[model samples]
Target: MEDLDTLVLRTALRWQATGLPVVLVTVARTWGSSPRPPGSLMAINGRGETVGSVSGGCIEDDLIHRIREGGVQAACATDTPAVLRYGISADEAHRFGLPCGGTVELVLEPVSSRSRLDELLQACLQRRSIERRLDLRTGQVELRDGRRDGVPRLDDTHLATCLGPQARLIVIGAGDLSRFLCQMALGLGFEVVVCDPREEHRASWELDGVVVSREMPDDLILRLRPDARTAVVALTHDPKLDDLALIDALQSDAFYVGAIGSRRNSAQRRERLHMHFDLPEAALQALHGPAGLYIGSKTPAEIALSIMAEVVAVKNGIRRPSPTPVVTGKSLHENPGYEVT
Candidate 1:
């Protein structure tokens, strides 16, 4: 089985064939509060690299060092997974610019082989959540089921959830927020789709890999049936689109279901939902609104960034309890008329 980094490296090689340079970096492990979880990957090429990171630049520098000292070919062939440590340690952390030595282990691999990466990428495209096992004893790799973990022979968790090379995001609307949200979501590896029945908005829409549709949002929600890995963001202010999707989202188990609005708006939205939609206080309250953190974002792009950041946190399996307003800030005032008969 091929890992995400190897697949990225292979992609780099494919791009390189068309005259682009690509490098693959993987996070083999992390100490604390690391930017990316283990198995996180970033690919760089001859011109520029993916912006996120493979560890503090030391590991990147090591790869660059290898590139300079050894040829790119030599660097690429160091196929074995390598362990790196960062920390609460003092001097070691400073050297890598890690706050307190937060060690992040990296497994760097050069991409050129189409054989393994092609297979892995294929599985992801098939929407299969695969667990790829790397045999540390030997450099052999194998892909297995996430649930079964077929090859328990590995000493660690080598499973990286594959969104099939494109992370899938469903945004309801084609407005300014949707445009910004789609673009930002795409940058973060999500294959986004914007749904709106309005003809005027869909015509001018433009974003690569985003599907624009006039289908009813609720219908689309049922059809899409977002999986655990998928995220649904309700962008339109209309509860027709937003609430319907929210109902489906609440039931379907998508990782994140958020509405873009303010605190008061969120409250009213919840009240409307609880009254008519049959959604419980628990489910209606599950939504994040004023979505995004209290980032003080006034512009569309900043708002998009905040939303994307929250989505990533959700993707990383961070569990944020529904904001009770009370625990985190103030408990929301209960609504009286909304109670069911």
Candidate 2:
């Protein structure tokens, strides 16, 4: 799935190329409690069609209404962007579905040839992070290579927004668990790729919007050169497939490198990597063995959910608690309602 900002830009580019007027709305600032964060984007065409979002639903509705009524066109007539505020008052907040005392400031830019929507879209498609600067007075735009996540920067004259690479997830397996994990990752806006050299698994694998690779795991990992925005998860549980790929992933810039396995197996794998491969202890420490958070998951779906949750937490720079054993009194078949005493 494309990231929200990228989707918004692509939609705007399409509308503009079709000779339709488009307006790009960005959540420039927010206070108290806002559904969308700063730099969130929404694009609306002259025909009231919209893509992406800056708020829940109310803000988009209001924007659509304004577009239909020519309010937005009139505001952009001078070829200068306008800043609009919503939910300033209690009634307004409630009416707009904003939390109490919440406020959202938006920058509405009338899209045109000079908006460079196409250039921005190209950069994003090429997986290049960029910094986009918009002049508040002249509606001009400037694009540059960006190294960090984009944040909205508003001063007296210009607003600078960061547009970063879409997060990528490479699952080193094509199985039931991989299917669930890929789906969840897609819903989370990750460009997912599943790699399995085995023909039987590859033949049976069927999931939309995911790229399936028959390339060997280590070679695929090397070619991908996983960055900070990338995550690699090995669910095959086969050492020959999982270990080599994991070694390459750990040595790369990937923010998360995890493998699904039992605690004992995880330890044995680490020992082998150290003894035979001579992988450094620090790199081994970076590997997430027995991957997911401890949730006592017994099924593939639940395990996938736990792993994705952990990956998200790490991506958000949240420190997770150390893994713990799932405490249960007895097997589910023996004690369906088993509880730890």
Candidate 3:
């Protein structure tokens, strides 16, 4: 599934191409709590058809009603964007389904050729992070390259919003675990790709909305050139396939690089990476072995859930305590094959 921003932009562009009057609403600011973030987007056309959302149903309903009643048209008649605030009072909060003290401010821009929705969509599709500046007085827009995601910046004259590339997940296996992981990632708005060179594994694989690649893992990773928004997870458990891809991933900008294995296997994998591959200890430390949050997951689906949870936490820059149980070197020495399940 495409991210919400991409969906909103594509819908708006399609609506505009048909010569329909469309309005694009952006959540510019929020206070207390909000269902959507500051950069969230919503678009509505003259027929009251809508795509995307700025709030939990209530605000969208209100916007539709106002558009139908010409409230939005009156504001757009001057070809200038308008700022709308919701849930200012206790009663209004209740009506709009917001938390007691929650408030949200939106910038409503009438879609036009000057809005540059097409150009923005192109940039996003090309996987370029961009900053879009909207002039409050003239409704004109400017697009430029950006490196980070930021909350909407609104000043007296303009509102600048960041539009980043969609998050990507590269699962280095097309097994049962990969199927579950890919589906979950897709639901979480990740562009998923599964790579498996084994013909038997590739032949039986079947999943929608995911790209399946038969290329070598390391070659594929090099080609993908994973950015900070990308994640790499190896579920194959085969060192020949997982290790090389993980090495490439660790050398790249991928925010998450993990491999599924038992405790003993994870330790062995690390040693192999350091000794055979001559990878530095600091680089090897980035690999999440025995990947997942140690949730005692016994099923493939449960394991996938645990792995995705950790990936998301890292993506959000949240520091979490290691869930792996501590074991002494003497204990490992005594039981060479000891594994944590």
Candidate 4:
């Protein structure tokens, strides 16, 4: 499935192309305890149909009611843009189903030729990050190359936001674990690729909606040269397949690089990378050996869940305790007297 943001934008563009009125809503700012952060996007059509979300169901309901009661103009009121705020008071917060003290500010703009959503969507599909600056008064927009991520900026005259590329994943092998992991990643809006040079493995690789490659893992890594928005996971138990990819992935800008193995094998993998590959200690330190957050996962599906959880945690900048990793957790389970140092 497409990422929520992309789905919203694409649906909005489709509606607009079909001569339907559409309003693009963005969460410009938020106060304590908001569900959606700044830069979140949603789109509503003339018929009150919506894609994406700005808040919980209550906020969306309010927007839909406005459209149904007064048409698209109820939200935008004009061809330009409009600013809206919700949940300033306790009663208002409760009515809108917001957490106590939560508030959200939105910019609602009527989708028009000036909105340039088509160009924006094109950039997103191409995996290019673009900053869209919307003039609050004129509804004019400017698009430029942008960083992969940033908070939305709003001023008296302009709103500057980044429309970054979708997050990507490169799986270094194809197996039951890889299939489960790729499925989870796809649902989480990651563009997933599965690479396996082994002909036997490639012959049986039949997952849908994933890019399958027969190139060697290391070669694939070098070709893709994963960016900050990319993640690499080595699932093949074979050191020949997982190690080279791990080596190259650790040297790239990928936000997460991981390998699945037993605790002892994980240590050996690290040692091999450091010695035989002449990789730096710092680079090897970035690897997630026995990849996954510890959850006593024995089945392939459960292991995939743990690994995907760790990948997302790292992506969101959520730092878990050292004891949470699979290796550490298994160690503590096997040896209760063992301490985390």
CA lDDT scores, all candidates in order: 0.64, 0.85, 0.87, 0.88
C-alpha root-mean-square deviation, each candidate? 6.4, 3.7, 3.2, 3.4
In candidate 2, position 6 carries an lDDT of 77
Pick by lDDT: 1 or 3, better one = 3
lDDT of 1 by residue, 7-103 (tens): 5645565766787545555566576656566666676665444534666566566566655565555455554444345554677667667656477
Tens digits of lDDT, candidate 4, 133-170: 99999999999999767889998889999997789999
Cα lDDT tens digits for candidate 2, 243-337: 98998998999999998876667778899999989999999998887787766677778888888989998998875545555446422211111
Better of 2 and 3 by TM-score: 3
Can you list the residue pairs that collide in candidate 2? 150-162
The C-alpha TM-scores of every prediction are 0.70, 0.92, 0.92, 0.94
Specify the highest-TM-score model's number: 4
CA displacement after TM-score superposition, residue 10 of candidate 2 (Å): 1.1
lDDT score for residue 43 of model 3: 93
Off by over 4 Å in 2: 75-77, 325-341
- Poorest stretch of ten by lDDT in candidate 2: 332-341
Worst 10 residues of 1 by lDDT: 332-341
